[model samples]
Target: MPVLQTVTRETFWTIGPVGEAAFYYLAAVAILVFLYGVYARISEYAAAPADPFDRLDDLPGRVARATRLLLSNEAQFDRDTYAGVMHTFLVWGFLTLLIGTTILAIDMDIWTKLLGQPSFFVGRFYLSYSLVMDALGLLFVVGVGMALWRRYGVRESRLWGKHTDLEDDAFVWTLFALGVGGYVVEALRILGTGFPDFETVSFVGYALALLGQEAGISPATAETVYAAVWWSHSLLALGFVALLPYAKPVHMLTSMANIVTRDEQAGKRLPGVPADLPPDEIGTGSVDDFTWRERLDQDACTTCGRCSSVCPANEVGRNLDPRDVILDLKAYREERAAGEAEEVPIVADGGESVIDAESMHACLSCMACMDACPVDIEHVKQFTGMNRRLTESGEMDPHVQDAMMNVFQQGNVFGDPARKRPEWTDELEFEVPDAREEDVDLLWYVGDYPSYDERNERVAQSLARIFEAAGVSYGILYEDEQHDGNDVRRVGEEGLYEMLVEDNAAAFADAQFDEIVCTDPHSYNTFTHEYPEMAEEFDYPVSHYTEVVERLVREGQLPLSPALGQTVTYHDPCHLGRMNDVYEAPRDLVRSTGATLAEMPRNRADSFCCGGGGGGVWTEVEEERKPSEERLREAVEDTDGAVEQFVVACPMCTTMFEDGRKTGGYEEDLEIVDLTELLVEAMEAAAIDGADDTGRTGAAAD
Candidate 1:
């Protein structure tokens, strides 16, 4: 009766009217629900204040970045190898299954119906497709199994029950059930139709068919059972689609969107707040004030704890965990939307705001969380925005409030006299040029800490000696230098930060110098990255001291011994290394010191913070174990007791670790020397080796 003598195949393969109608109905409903979920979220996001999504500029570049983060899973895998591979399997399996479903649609709806073909999807090509799909389906099964094991089986990890609750558990189980159900429906189909050559390619299906055969299920009876399963599997698939909006699965879409739309400066760029704001608009007071991208950050979080895990504050048991702050904001947004929020500062009885004031102020603003986040969620910006709200509401932390007033009154964080700035230079051997008096090749922006802190003053003097021996005509702002405001802005003292920036920019404009150089990374980042817009006259090639010293060494201006026996480890300043990407310059400077370089477990972009960033040097953290101490332990262990010198390039880093070695009881073995000090020693040695009585090099003699 059949036109083709086949044991198993499908043109519509006798899919009865009832089965066909049910499948189409469920599918249509699934499509409608999925579309509705997507459209509603998109509409809500689009309604946020205009970013004028530049749809065309570097679109290909944007797509490539998305493909790396999403399609390639670069960020995910780069952090956690096992979890990355596990996630990859799930992603590939899902994509393959979706493709198979699409192909089936094309074969039936277009090939057979539209073209009136005898039918394809039947021979070797079909067999290969079937085999591939079955293997991939098994891959999906394995992935789900692994997820269950990782989520429930593993007891030590924080992966499952710690942050995720019963709802998350339900989501994973539902997903696995749907995946496993697919094969049950397939195996039943193959048995119901009388096994054939193509069915042999479906290994999972064929194996299950053998079990059914042992049970003595006749082909006709098998068909009857398949009819029931066919509807059940279809309904589950439909339900999975319908659950997209209300579950953790929603990160699938949101995370991808967040990565692709990541701002040009890689999530470090924060939108500048207007100086003049209506009373209510002073800060990001509520969800309505958040830009759409910020809202997307709340939705996109994978709750993986990568951000929270790396946060210095969180690591030290401080009140803030960046990840929880985002989650709290999301919950707070929901509560407000439902008109459930009823209290000032949103502490309804107690929990008014998503993140309370103490936790909000505890953030280091170190950007560690930003670097750790795979999805490019800017936790620092959001935390700082909330800090803005707290500062304006007069609920600012007492210490930060004191720091702000100190900056206003003394033009420095320490509340020391402004005249104390140039005092460090008086200790330098050579007469240090003051830019206000004479034109110089470089204007050294002596930072607050470098100018006044006793330990940091020696580091600043080392910089001056290196510059002098290198024959660079550099000068300092001396007493004219204002507090650079990098930390001030980070502290959310925007009013004082603006005043400082304006004052400092005016100082720069008045000074005569070819380039700007800073001994402190914080001031360097602020001058080079943050101060340009406020003062157009502040346009100069600003550089950090390490970079300038490295350049001098490269040009043979600063000759080095190039052969030493000390094992040295360089600590990358978060601002110098991660923020500005100056990892190699410092390392190269260390290399020229002729010391054997020993890296700690985490170095460069992955370098652990020294707990002195984000105004951290000024903020008092009362943790039993400090982050710098942790780093010192790492350095001691990583070098296996061989390291004699722990070199640092930033003043904050020198101060942090120099203090840490003592407080952490590591001072016995560790000596934290400035990178500039190392360079100065090496140059002096090279000068000794090459000089006649005059103490000048061959190049200088010419």
Candidate 2:
């Protein structure tokens, strides 16, 4: 193959004014269309504002973080090797091609006239640039090929079933043809015209031209073919632009936007419910209660099924599919666009040819979907919002309604008297402070479960022992504490959650605690992250017990006697680990006991839910086999030959694991303990009991 030189300015000018005008007009129209798409997207956001100021302020940080994530090695996965490599190539290739196009437009339309001639930059560099682009296009085609094969050939790739496979095939094939055909056309032009300046670098084109000559095509006919192919290729490029906004290709833009606008506090423990919220203004209680950005999350879902694949609930035969939830929202949007007369039932799930109540209730509200989604669609938040809609506006199931009523009337999910909240503290030797008279530095927010549940009181006592051993300044709300309503909120009792938040907030406001520590991850998550928005709310720093233990260990306030000599696996409480991103603190606390930390295949953000979140702790949903049983099996299997002890940080997780172990027939071999329990053991082993460990103590005993 003979390498051709690029064209000179005079030669470029003679390429025909009519063809140039067509290119310019098409470019202008494409730009206008792109601008209109941007306008529509922005307008949609404008209609709903949720934490706009926070999102805006966090934008730069999110971009930097997302870029780092994209470039970093952390996102690599062995199973999706082809998809990952191809996606990276496509992203980089498209970015460079867009830059090349912009430069081409400016050089041809603006720079040439202003400077009295198009600079040699484009022609001299065009061959090399085009060759690189052509190579990338080829890579993109390969990527598309693999995607198609995965969709059609591999039954396990769930991404195939959600959307039409043919649509994907068409989209991929079209892109491939455009890239290959465009390169071929351009190469033909260079060959038919003979070697021009800087044409040597167009490797693919040069190869094609040589191949053409070898086939004995006449130069005149080749020139005609070249021109026709070139026009067709350009038209295809233009067509892709017009089709982008309506097709899955739109994810190229929305994905980045989704990443940029992702919630910064995602995975962090939600703060405790505020202490001073008025009765009327509390938790989200209905469909209209959601913030606008939460609704925007519906549009942002890419329907990748990453959430579904990782969802513990869905994997264990639960009816809730996170992917389906997002798809339903997209379907709902499509229906709205079509101006369909029928109201698409948002909660139906097929038996009635409608979304069903079980589909919504089946969700454990684990937040696993949120953790797994690449674009950061807030699946847990969306599910919670829908739950509010069904439970508060629509009539809820009888048991669910009963549970909510119990929480509302009795201040506990179990319909127990509020005064029983202090009963757990009687087992401790120390006299815990009441919120009314205590000037404690830390207010232990004893949640309903640990306070009343027979097995959970041990967790509370363990927390107290750890607090005393660490010489920390802490006290408890004792009798003054009420249910924080996390269960009620998850179970769809918005009014109860609000009332609970108000009552708890009032107690805290009247008390003298500077900080709040919670034994329950659910309470910690809600109080630390979700409570401050209520009117007249006083913001308090809330810490999970593990976080407090970690802090104490770091400060050298608490000392371990010796290694526990036990191999233990840690289970992530969804609310604590996924919702609040408190994964490390608990693990760090576990390690502080000098116990060997073994991981389940699903640990940290990928951890399985214990089937006791989102008020599932209180409501009864039928399962072929219990979700806890499935989770326990996974835990036991992960540690089948190695570890016998499973340490959990959340009260609900503790309860679920205990029950799951019994159900799964592993109860005799496995032991489940709260993180604080291990810390208490470590303290006892060291024989370093503080004064309060054996006697009644004041708020400042530590």
Candidate 3:
């Protein structure tokens, strides 16, 4: 039998007797460099203060959610699947390797004393553990190999293509080679030095030793090769550590840290601005206005394109790319950090270009990117803040200025006078409240579309009939309600949104209503989540029409009769579903009407936008063809011929669907109705008398 070679006895002095001294000095220098880089970056982020840390006390909950995200299937279908998997492997494997190296750093006698003799059970267990770690390290190398190949060989890989410069590719390749070479060296050491006297841990290394023997290489030669490889591996790993904070690989540490510090309820809309905040101090007007946490998010972006992949605006050929927004912000910050004084130019594929224009304006503010992001970066809120900057700073575009003026002067995007708001309700018999009067049970905020558009007026009429039939005490604002300014804010008019919120809040402050409900999801979202600061001052709850309807149905106050057995698919309005998580209430209301709900594959939080959100309903896209036409085709396909009707709860969705129905030539086959309209039909069938039912003297006998 071949004599077992020992690693301790096979040492060679390549850099003289001072080699160990040189290694220690080098390691210290690398650590200092890395620490300095981290300190600088963190200080830059700390310059901006964020929202008060309400989440700091929720550490356990944050960890639990993060663990679920890591272990669950939420990340399986991501565009960067391979990259993510490889990154995971590298993280876990490298950690284990660090433990192994620490063990090697200590005296063998000390390790034996702590773990017991090699023949003892605890020692054997550790040996098995190390062997398993070796296997994991090999697996990690294979994953890295796949990543390298994808980066270099696959031309279409978004991570590696022309979008990535050579520096990025070099960074990735160096990290890959370092990880692979480190493990290879360890395996060789195990084979050449069987002095540790553990068979299982040395399994692969022993096998390699036999192959070397068969190749006629002497035992001493193999040992020497192992030492060289080991040194090279250690040196390369040290280099990687020093380079980390400056490269994209910094995400390895920061992503995990960000995850650890992630908000327990990440996508929730933050409480609305405080009503007491002085109007002069209320708006975010520049990059200087971003909070620390927000800036951390800007730095934490991995640029994986997950946001872009799911962006409705980008998919529909709009100039906005959520990923690019983050990249630009980060790049700009980095330039600022490097003492660059020149303003960064904003460029996209289209002729559309503007310097200092908030990238937020181009965004639909849909929140799809937040849903799709693996890191849970809050793009919607950040975008909103940017828009706040442009508007509050008085640096808005001419078009945005015009739109805001229309909303402020006319109380509608169409620039129609506020007097026309009550024109739609003229044909109705019941009395609607002024909304600015004393409190009532409910306040109906009739948005511009239902008030002005002829086709949408029918929806308003349907809502009035349903309210009357449900026996619910409700009253509309009629001429008293304003536009609410969701579109104004989305179109980069923060001043207008602020003006609208303050105006609406004042109207509600004097009113006696316990809750405010609206037919338009845009108005509903702005009221429920955005206007809370103002609403809280008035002590009122802002709810969507669907939420109120769902509440009524659950309380057994509204008797719904199943008359329309038509199969219908519910389209999620971006504002209602993604912005406020009002997905279930609308569907529940539809189900209450006895319609079989056919859900689109993309429903709820992941639902595709109707191309009518974020003020797109008012602004013309000037496209060769309208985006709603495509969305209608998708909705029609999702319906699967179950019935003729498509249910919508948003005025914007109604308009988009109607246009889609016309453009797709499905006018003869399909009809779109708001959820309120469907509920009215059910109410009419039930014959229940509501508080305002003037025509009906008595409830029909059941």
Candidate 4:
């Protein structure tokens, strides 16, 4: 008989003043405890050796971008669509319910008590809010169900593979009960209120109320049951909030902070070592060596194992599980934060270490872990610091040591003399110009591997032929060239890397070139990003050779006749594609030669590593399968052997994949060819009259 306006619910329907007072008392304690937990976590972060919050160049823009990213759930969807949708529902649903509750509190306490206003939680506004809350609340329930199914039913591998405790499950179950319990309480309250017409707008609760009425529950009993359930639900939700900073649920807060504070240059341009820093402080060896941001990284980890799942080292059964590195550091951080004796090392050769030496050494530094991390944990940043410590302690792999020594003594990793750097060019019919002696449009920085490695030397000469065919003015540093030290820096020899940088920067300063180009993505990456940071005056423009070639072809500077006529698959180098966002140029070059590009399952930014980054080309690690071998199999098997040629842009990838092809028994199925070699083959076929087999003709032939 009542109108909808008169069908509103009270804030404290069944509870009297005493119960209300008691509820408020518990609420105060919960709020205080939550604040204390937050403070304690902040204090721990503030105590880290360095302040990692210096990225304030665009404070407002950073916050806005991070907020947009978090809400978008783009990172969550990067590799796992199922997990992405699951997390999206959970996060949005939780926020909706939270907002609904906060509105209720404002209506009851703030607006009604402080502002002396009539309650807004009634009639039209209330009905709309109830309907919205009920619908979104179902999202929370569905998300919890999906999580349970993924974790227990389907058993997602990414969620496993690490040591987990009750807290992990407890965090999910708490959300489950909180969401489910709220529905039950809502239904009982509606039934106890006699199922008023206005309350039907809360459709989920209304339907459940009908079920309760069908069960023949009396209004008196419904009221009593609702009271008990309401208290339990409220207490559980409050307790979850209070315990957030101390349990697995802490990722909720820390993940947001980490995303907001993440370095855009993270793995691309690593933090440099100071010139005068003491040897003991060279790298991260203890909890005290961590930065505040890195400590936040420890807390931000969800233990989802996404990092480990994507890691080339971990995938092939290397000891380097990226997820374990973070968790181990987190455990040690807590122990130290608890005022325990700091006797245990963060990383060591023995059991006293939280992180093992094998795991640290096994890292390829591909940044796949960082890319896959939804929370932006910067795994490479943390791992590189530890690597520096290992280098400082003389704990490098024997191969790594030899490579470092070679770079130090010979200005290259192959232990070859400087005069031999230009030996690869002697095979070319045309003489390659020396950059030091004359100005050129392009300074071809033929990196160490391409300069000296026999397998890659032919590829370098092919690029030189391509340059001659296009009539582009390009020159090499010749004997003046030194190693770029990209991989050396990744391997953590700060002093050696500095020496290499200094030597190369001097050559670069002396050379007269409009732009620097490299066939080595590793060299291109460091020259474009790290070199300028270390060398004050080394700010020359740099381009990958693929980018240069692709542009030349596009602009008709280099004519192509599409003479390849072969089905090929292209591999994206980590430094080029993922780290530097140069994904399409090399593929464009592959297509320029009239090759049919059959896409690999993992292409572009998702391309699998060739196991040659971070000095992986130098260091040897035993594994069930090498990452290079695994990738070769993917190109051959995933493409069903349709790919006759495996085209790569990087000299490092060329070296790694050539070995992989031979050893993995893919020699018959695939041929590992550099993009330049493939391009040169097409260019030679396109050459007109007076053109020799070397593709030089007309004015170039003269």
Instruction: Pick the TM-score winner.
Output: 4
TM-score: model 2 vs. ground truth: 0.85
Candidate 1 off by > 4 Å? 1-8, 11-15, 51-57, 110-120, 160-163, 207-222, 340-351, 691-702
TM-score (all chains, Cα) for each model: 0.92, 0.85, 0.82, 0.96
* Shift in Å, residue 122, candidate 2: 4.4
Compose the digit string of candidate 4's lDDT tens values, residues 209-281.
Answer: 8988899987789998777888898889888878887889888899988988888878887888877889877
For all candidates, the clash counts are: 4, 29, 6, 0
lDDT of 1 by residue, 3-74 (tens): 223433663334687768767787888888888988888888888765423433687887788877665766
What is the alpha-carbon lDDT of model 4 when measured against the actual structure? 0.86
How well is each residue in 112-182 modelled by candidate 2, as lDDT tens digits?
A: 76767846444436556666766776666666666556666774466754554565666777777866785
TM-score of 1: 0.92
Error of 4 at 585 (Å): 0.9
What is candidate 1's CA lDDT for residue 354? 56
Residue 105 of candidate 3: its Cα lDDT? 45
Candidate that scores best on lDDT: 4
The TM-score ranking, best first, is: 4, 1, 2, 3
